[model samples]
Target: MTSAAPTTHIVFPLYPGVTHLDFCGPHQVFARLPGVHLSVASEGGRDIEAEGLVFAGLEDLATITHCNVLCVPGGFGCVEAMERPGFMAAIRRLAGSADYVTSVCTGSLILAAAGLLEGRHAACHWAWRHMLTEFAAIPDEGRVVNDGNIWTGGGVTAGIDFALALVARIAGVGVAQTIQLALEYAPAPPFDSGRPDLAPETVVNGYREKLADVLRDREAAIRRVAAGRANRASQ
Candidate 1:
């Protein structure tokens, strides 16, 4: 099924520590859309490996002259991306010009840093929700949020929901519903620990422990990124 648009470039900004689900989920949904072009972009057309899977065919950020849609995937390396002048510049430039800009997980942080989240209600991984405040973003707890042209999704798997919602918004409810039905989007979690509100105390504690480790590492990287940004600003 071909889309009405001649071409829709869906850009994925790649970096280390990127969650495989973030890109894969959305890619699955977007690929089904007609006439949609997908590009996995990086600082340079360099090869990037996500969770041990090597991607050697990724394009450089500069190759995206214009985009209909931009999909930013989240990872541990967002701080590094935020600090890179060329990287941040590419995001700010391209995403600013994009008709629609969307992000998954902590990728929202990158968008926030690029000053694209102002006055937009966005969502991100609950573990990192507070960080959006640093960028003057109104954070929501939903799995996905669509605020004007900006679309944001919570952690990893939530990207599927976000992408499906975007499909419905752009293509129509019929298209989204069709895809959802084909993909068996019916989700029945074995346990009710998906969110803290529904999880048992022990399950929530375990999730917290896992998040604490990530927070520690993220905090250190964030400080370095902040310093780098400040340095660039001063220069």
Candidate 2:
């Protein structure tokens, strides 16, 4: 008799103001994985509004104790999410037993706040990647960075690439390729301005200017989180 394939439980913890693409892109990829059981949960099992869309019927993250993989998605509410004691505690608990700890975009910041990314290399949005250093995590410019069992994706769309890489690791390159084909994951952007280096100076500067206020706020929040972590460690 043949043995049944073991299930891989993948959990995604959601919060308000989350960027839909950050989780949706990866969710689509992971859903295609064989023997994968995906769960989307929020702090209180309540509905979440993200980028104008409402995600309903979510499981409470506090109720989930274990998972094979934990993928945290990023959004504008990330700084606030990092500050939530319950949210951070749940993250630490889930990551403690997860076979793989991962994040998309600014979600890496949450992992760092949870004390999971220290001494590891991670990827985040180009605008905020430098903040990872504050948490003792080396920020990488790669679209997807894998350091040990920690996987992080750069920005929003990169979540798809990150998920595909993780799928390759969990299953096999052939299986990942098959799924890529099934989804027709091909990219041919009309512009060559995806990265800071590739983007025109004016565009980059304009974007930086536009993000200045939020960036300042995020930095302040990260500093507080880092300081608190340092204090806890010292105590």
Candidate 3:
């Protein structure tokens, strides 16, 4: 008789304002993996409201002692999430023992804020990618980036691709391909404006303008966090 394969525990650390797709896309992919145990956790094991959706009954991040993977999802609340002492502490602790440290979109920023992405290449949403520099992280323009055991995906939709890549890494290309086929993961966007480089200048500018206020607030928050981290390091 053959012994069972070791179970892979994958944990997703969530906070309010998270883009549902950021974690849900990957969650769907990982759920199909054989011998995988998945957990969606929050700082307090409380219900989280995101983009008008409510997620309840979450495990507390502090309660999970160990996991094979630690995947953080990005969202509008990421800056606030990074500022939370308990949340950041839990992230640092779990990442310290995780076989893989990963993030989707601005989630990479959270990892950077946790001091996990220093000097590492990471990926994030285009609008906020530059912010990674504040944390000493090099931002990559790739939809998915892998540096050592740290893997990061670009904006929302990229999480699926990132998950597939991770599945391939953890399981095998064959398994990843099987899952993709099963899910019918073929994507064909109706417009060529998914990326700034491909979109019309006016469209890009308009989107940037719309984001200006939020960007300013996020920038301020990140700077404060970065300064705090620097001060702590010097002490």
The candidate scoring highest on lDDT is: 3
Give the per-residue lDDT digits (tens) of candidate 1, residues 6-103.
77778888877678788989989988887788888887888887888877778999877878788998987777778777888888888877989999
Q: Report the Cα lDDT for candidate 2.
A: 0.95
Query: Which order, best to worst by TM-score?
Result: 3, 2, 1
Off by over 4 Å in 3: none
lDDT of 3 by residue, 1-235 (tens): 9999999999999998899999999999999999999999998898889898999999988899999999999999999999999999999999999999999999999999999999999999999999999999999999999999999999989999999999999999999999999999999989999999999999999999999999999999999999999999999
Model 2 misplaced regions, further than 4 Å:
none
TM-score of 3: 0.99
TM values, all candidates? 0.90, 0.98, 0.99
> Between candidates 1 and 3, which one is better according to lDDT?
3
* Local distance difference test scores for all models: 0.84, 0.95, 0.96
The pairs that clash in candidate 3 are none
Q: Which is the winner by lDDT between candidate 1 and candidate 2?
A: 2
